[model samples]
Each structure stands twice: as structure tokens, then as C-alpha cells.
Target: MNICVYCGSSLGKNEKIKEQAISLGELMCKRGHHLVYGGASRGIMGVLADSVMQNGGEVVGVIPKNLFKKEVAHKGITELITVDGMHQRKSIMADRADAFLALPGGFGTLEELFEIITWNQIGIISKPVVVYNLNGYFDSLIQMIDHAVDVGFIKPGNRKILRVAETLEDCMKFCEQEL
Candidate 1:
């Protein structure tokens, strides 16, 4: 299966989160799954891609042309695809991936995760969306989703679209079930 991971372009201050990203990459490789992600050679994105490659896993990078020009694109990935813009990049990544997972990140990561979830909600895609909420990183976000459901802003059934996993093991388990 091709698993698409949306993560930070910069590694956060926490060492454990970085380690978790590495572990997640290693797990994907060990499980013989291919990785599809934003093609950048910085932050958690770089670490995850490098770990997967080191473990002999196939990685497909979908980077926007602008970022590629900025020289943040991963040159060592199994395959690197450059798109014209962010929307095109996301479309190609979504098309290439069988499942989606989100790691700790800032606005970009949240945006990608929410976009994928929204796509699934609107029937644009039915792939599974998993969020790796390491150390309660996404606790508040999850609570907000629950609040949305309570206020009738979101359907109760739609809340299940985003599966929250606290560890790499849990994420892998969800992937296995979904795929």
C-alpha cells in the first residue's frame, strides 16, 4: 500500500516527536509499504523520507515547483514528482496514496490533514485518515472536532473520519485495518 504522510517541514523542538517520525518511517518500510509525501528535505519530512530510504522502502515525493526551486526537494527519494502548485501537489499525492497519516506539524500539516478528511467526508475519497497524536499534540484539535459534532456543525458519523492514534504501532494497526 502507498501511505501518504503529512508532517512538518521543520522538526519541532521536541526530540521525542522527531524520534516518533523516524519510527513511523521505519515501520512503514519494514511493513513493505510505499510512502507518498510532500517532497521536502527539511524537518520531520526529511527525517521520515531518509529513514524510509535507509530501510529500503520506496518513497514518492510530490513537491511543488516553487519548493523544488528553493532546493528543499528530496533528491534521494525513490521517485520525485514536481507539481505546479500546492493544490496540484495535494491532488497527485492523494491519487497516489492508498491511505493518509498525519504527524506533528504546524499549519501545513493541519491543512493537509483537514483537506483529506474533508475529501473523505464529501465522497471525493474514501481512504483512511490517521493522525499520530504523539504526547497529546492533537488533544485540543480532537476536542474541537468533538465540539463541532456536539454543536451539529459536523455529523457524528463524520467524526470517525479522522482516526486518532497515539503511537506508531497504533497508526500501523489502523492502516492495516483500513487497507
Candidate 2:
């Protein structure tokens, strides 16, 4: 399966979260799962790709041209796809992925996660959308989502589109689902 991961380009200072990236890569490699992610050679993104490659897993990186020009693209990845802009990059990522996973990240990661979740809600895609809520990184966001459902801003059934995985095992289980 091709699991599209959304994560920060800058590896944050959270040691546990950082290590989880490595574990995720190892798990994917062992499971023979392909990785589809933002092409960057830094931070959590770098660690994840490197771990997969080191463990003999295929990684397909979808990177924007601007970021590629900045020399942040992972040249060592199995394949690095160059795109014109964020929109194109996202469209291609969604097209190439069989599932979506959100790791700890910054604004861009959150945006990507939400967009994919929105796609599932709108029936644009029927794949499983899971968020790795490691270290409670996504606690507030999940709360807000529940609040939206509580206030009827989001239909209760729509809120069920997102699967919040609190551990690596949960994330992998979500990935293994046929959806």
C-alpha cells in the first residue's frame, strides 16, 4: 500500500515524536508499504524517508519546484517528483496514495491533513484518513473537531471520517484496512 504521510520539514525538539518517525519508517519497510510524502531531506521528513530507504522500502517523494530549487528535496529518495506548486503537489499526492497519515507537524502539515480529511468527508476520496496523535500533539485539534460536531457545525457522521490513532500500532492498523 502507498501511505501518504504529512509531517514537518523541520524536525521539532520532541524526542519521542522524532523517534516515532523512525519507527514508522521501519514498520512501513517491514510491512512492504510504499511511502508517498513531501520530498524534503530535513527534519522528520528526512528521518522518515531515510529510515525507509535504509530498511529497503520504496519512497516516492512529491516535492514542489520552489522547495526543490531550495535544495531541500530528497535526492536520495526512490523517486522524487517535481511539481509546479502546492496545489499540483497535493493533487498528485492524493492521487498516488492509498491511505493518508498525519504526523506531528507545523501549519503546512495541518493544512494537508485537513484538506485530505475534507476530501474524505465530501466523498472525493474514500480512503482511510488517520492522524498519529503522538504526544497529544493533535489533542486540541481533535477537541475542536468534536466541538464542531457538538455544535452541529459538522454532521456527527462526517466527524467519523477521521480516525485518530494514538499509537504507531493504531496507525498501522488503519493503514492495513481495505477502506
Candidate 3:
């Protein structure tokens, strides 16, 4: 499976989250899955790309030209594709991926995952989206989503578009079975 992983370019407060991202990448490679992600040589993205490459898995990184310098795009990637802007990067990644997984990250990570889910919900795509809820990092966000559903902001069925897992194995299994 070609899995697109959305994560942060800056490491968060917790070291465990970063470790879990690395573990997830290693697990994906071992399972014979390719990784598709933003080509940054920092933070969770960096850890993930390195893990996949070390484990002999294909890593396709997509980055916007404007942020290439700022993000310090990963040159060690199996394949790095540069685009004009964020939209182009996201478009290419989504098109190439069979599924999407989000690791613990900041607002940027949240934005990326939310965009994909929105795209899926609006019929732009039909790929499976999973969030690796490392250490319950997304607890508050998940609560907000539930509140949205309760307030009739979104239908209950729309909630089914996202799957949350506490571990890499659980997330991968959900992707293989549900996606």
C-alpha cells in the first residue's frame, strides 16, 4: 500500500510522539508499504523518511518550491518531487497515496489531515484516513469533532471517514482492512 503520512516539520514537546512516528515508518517498510509525505528533513517528517529508507522501503516526498529552503527538503528520499505551492504538494501526495495517516503534530499537521478528510467527505477522494493518536495527543481535537457532530455541524456518518489508533500496528491493520 502507498500511505501518505502527514506530520510536523518541528518536533513537538513529547519525545515519545517522535519515537512512535519513527516506529510507524519502520513498520510500514517492514510490511512492504511505500511512504508518501511532505519532503522535510526535520521533525516527524524527517524521522519517518529516514526510518523508511533505512528499512528498504520506498519514500516519495513532495514539497513546495517556496518552502523548500525553509523546510530544508530531504535529499535522501527515494524520490523527491518539488511543486509550486502547498496546494500542488498536497494534490500530488493525495493522488499518489492509497491511504493517509497522521502522526502527532502541531496545527500544520492538523490542517493537512483535516483537508484530506474534507476532500474525502466532499467526494473529492475516497481514500482511508487514519490518525495515529500517540499518547492521546489528539484527545481534545477528537472531542471537538464529536461536539461538531452533536451540534449537527456534520452528520454522524461523516465521522466514519476517520479512524483513530493508539499504535502503529493498529493503524496499519485498519488501513489494510478498512481502506
Model 2, residue 128: C-alpha shift (Å): 0.7
By lDDT, the best candidate is 2
* Candidate 1: pairs in clash: none
All candidates: CA RMSD (Å): 1.1, 1.0, 0.9
- Pitting candidate 1 against candidate 3, the one with the higher lDDT is 1
Which lDDT tens digits does candidate 1 get at residues 10-48? 888999988988888889988889899999988899999
* Model 3 CA deviation exceeding 4 Å by range: none
Q: How close is candidate 1 to the true structure, as a TM-score?
A: 0.97
Question: What is the clash count for each candidate, in the order shown?
Answer: 0, 1, 0
Q: Please list all clashing residue pairs in model 2, or write none if there are none.
A: 11-43
TM-score of each: 0.97, 0.97, 0.97
Per-residue alpha-carbon lDDT of model 3 for 73-129, expressed as tens digits? 999989999999889999999999999999887787889999999999999999899
Q: Candidate 2 on 1-179: residue-level lDDT in tens?
A: 99999999998888887899999999998888989999999889999999999999999999988898563899998999999999999999999999999999999999999999899888899898899999899999999999999998999888877899998989999977856
